[model samples]
Target chain A: MKKVALLTAAIIICAVPFYGQHFITKNGHISFYSDGPLEKIEAHNKQVNSALNIETGDMVFKVLMKSFVFEKALMQEHFNENYVESDKFPNATFKGKVVNMSDITLTKDGTYEADVEGELTIHGISNKIEDKGTFIVSKEGIHGNSKFNILLADYDISIPGAVTGKIAEEIEITVDVKLKKFSK
Target chain B: MKNWIKVFVLAAVVGIGVLIYVWFFIYNKPHMNIEKATPDYIISASECYDHYANGNNNETLNYTGKVLQIYGSPSSIEKTDSLTVVVFTFSTGMFGDEGIRCTMLPSYSNEVSNSILSKEISIKGYCSGYNETDVILEQCSIIKN
Candidate 1:
């Protein structure tokens, strides 16, 4: 009985850090910029949901298509109605993992380069992506940031020939999120 | 020949005017004024969270992209240098507490004081959609009764 009790206590001690291994942020920020020949378009979505499991190097991000705010209401409308079809595909998601998770310690305070590979889905289509990101570990939280460019055609986001000059073929996406330790 | 020239000149002038109107008014229209917009749904925060938590896809669909006026006491109010976020927590999930997270407009940031904690208040914003854990609202403005 004493041996069983000792094993149970050891299990509890091992599981304590595991419980705090997950990090999450509901109010993450994601923005995309399009530099076209005729026009420059940019939109920002502040209410991004991102979760990261430091133990397993798993990460996921969910962004609402309708949450993207453009400076021009007409462009925003066109984006929802024509470009991305927000009604049909209301969310863009990424399910990926940090390839080099073993190099960084979460308890340590420093910025570490993160190599991420994942499936990014937009407009009901998914594509494999490999990119570099940074994880800044601070006393407050972990700040995750990445900048990458994605071709609209890769995700089946087609632009009409008439307004092709007003929208770029490749869009620059920036992700900035400060994640806090997730405790149940 | 003179009549044709006159007609062509008038058509060109009209075309230019149309292009100007399209460029200044239609193409560059201002964003939605959330302060003046009416709420499509008036609901409590808990009720809103329950709809998503129960996997009521149809019910959740009805609220997405629509303006909602939610009334509830915030579980936590996070004020930062950039924006203020008011969170209405429902239950603990795999990531964290799942609920409605309302990001107030920058102009209304000053109005969300710590004194309003646990006090019922109404906030109106555009419902972006559920991110599995929480229903996000942006361009939020506090509604004073």
Candidate 2:
């Protein structure tokens, strides 16, 4: 009990000083699309918590799996209760560092390329993912966008043979986040 | 006897078809109408945060997934392009702040035109699970007379 209290106190004390280097957004957007022969399906999640460190180029993203909203109510229900089992694994996250950190100055206003490699966890499965993203830093804030594709079977998401034709083998994921400097 | 059998069979088929239609179309509907739904718990924002932060196993289990009416003073108000968020942060995260991040429903946009930084308010929403950083709520509506 005492040790846990000490760690909590330590985290509180150290959290503020790191704010200067942290760029954050609570409303990061992520959408996934699957185009099959039968139907094209997609869902979007707008509430994502993400952080990027300008000083070190380390980045992290956290999103609630249940937050992914589908245009069709039936599709949303199937996604949570059937596919993802959101009650069992409520979140999907990515933790990684940008590859070429030294080439870009995040504080200065410019459009740059961000090459990041990270382990992305979805539906209780982790896979190493590498991608390039477009980033813009300006007076308003910073915007980052990345597009990638993944195979469903790789993540152990089983689609019964009955509905295999209805869903695609690979789904496309797009991430867009606007981060502002963290402050008190 | 033959005519009666056909009528019974026809009725049973139609009934099965109607049941499938309702299951696919109506029963599987998402819980979208949050304001009309009853909240499972009415708690202060601090109490809600504390449960996610340091509450016991069942205490934390008791709160997750239920609709909650949280009353608290706002610590920070943020108006992003896509979202109007009100935060009741208690813990400082790796980036300096963490608490309840409530994404308000669109109906309350006019009422909260700008920041309401310190006013005590009650908001109702579905309680999603908490990350180490913050407890999240969605589809929130301000409780007002």
Candidate 3:
């Protein structure tokens, strides 16, 4: 009880007051699906950090590259050491804004189609991309989800000839984040 | 006799190659079992948070990508989807927030359920890094009862 109280007090002290305009989630989930000729690979990372500004529709999310847990441990090792190089890059980040911000109504608690555009940095390489998603606001909280595909070659993640058929050229990515209003 | 020997050698070579491939890529390869594995660093959660707050590059270089057994008072215990996350926090920082957050695996759900909240407990997980406020550890498990 005391520790929770103290942590709560600290949160009140240090949190940036975005008020109703800010939403944040520390456990946002991101999963990627790769369909290869030899086999399919899937990995999920739930330790994603995301902050959204409901006022301007600006959003940012980051996931530690090594945080992505794979079903196969060898795949995880290969991913960090060979593909993404998590030791060197550490994280993949997306700093984008909801392009169709004006169309969404946050107070109404309805589904709104949104276009998100910004820089996506993977493996230390940044690329500008635009994608579509949905935003939902309700009395419970705010929810956002987006899906897109990324080519590994675009990020300079090269699959060696030995295992090229075991990996896909374009990996599908899905992002789901639930945010609560930021309070200070 | 020579032809028979050559065929046998080729078969042996192919068998060895397949064995190596299966051993490295397919056999016993999956999510790590952190609960049973030994921790690389045994440090208190508060001390670890202090390093993350004060030490910049050097701190990140040291802790990140390492396995940690962090002990502290549980600030909060919450479940997201099927995963249970035990958070250890300090009331000091720019955000007045710095701590170790451990996400336990599903196999430890029963143990996590029976855990006493607000008590000192130690957990083992991989240190991802300090993300401005909190040091993140994923695929965690209870280490100390």
Maximum-TM-score candidate: 1
Model 2, CA-based lDDT: 0.83
Candidate order by TM-score, decreasing, is 1, 2, 3
Candidate 3 lDDT over residue span A19-100, tens digit each: 2367787789999999998778899988788877777777888788878888788788888899999877887888888877
Residue B110 in model 1: lDDT: 85
How large a fraction of the reference contact set does each model reproduce? 0.69, 0.38, 0.33
Query: Candidate 3: where is the Cα deviation over 4 Å?
Result: A1-20, B1-28, B91-98, B113-117
Q: Please, what are the lDDT tens digits per residue for candidate 1 over residues A64-117?
A: 898898989988998998989987788899999998999988889999999999
**Model 2 native-contact share:** 0.38
Q: Rank the candidates by lDDT, best first.
A: 1, 2, 3
Clashes of each: 0, 0, 1
Model 1 Cα lDDT, one tens digit per residue, B1-145: 6999999999999999999999888987677787799999999999998987798889988998889999999888877657798889888776577789898999888888888789999999988788777888888999999
- The sequence of per-residue lDDT tens digits that candidate 2 reaches over residues A113-132 is 99999999988999999999
Instruction: Give the DockQ (2 decimals) of all models.
Output: 0.61, 0.35, 0.31
**Comparison by DockQ, 2 against 3, better one:** 2
Which lDDT value does model 1 have at A169? 95
Q: Where does candidate 2 clash, by residue pair?
A: none
Best by DockQ: 1
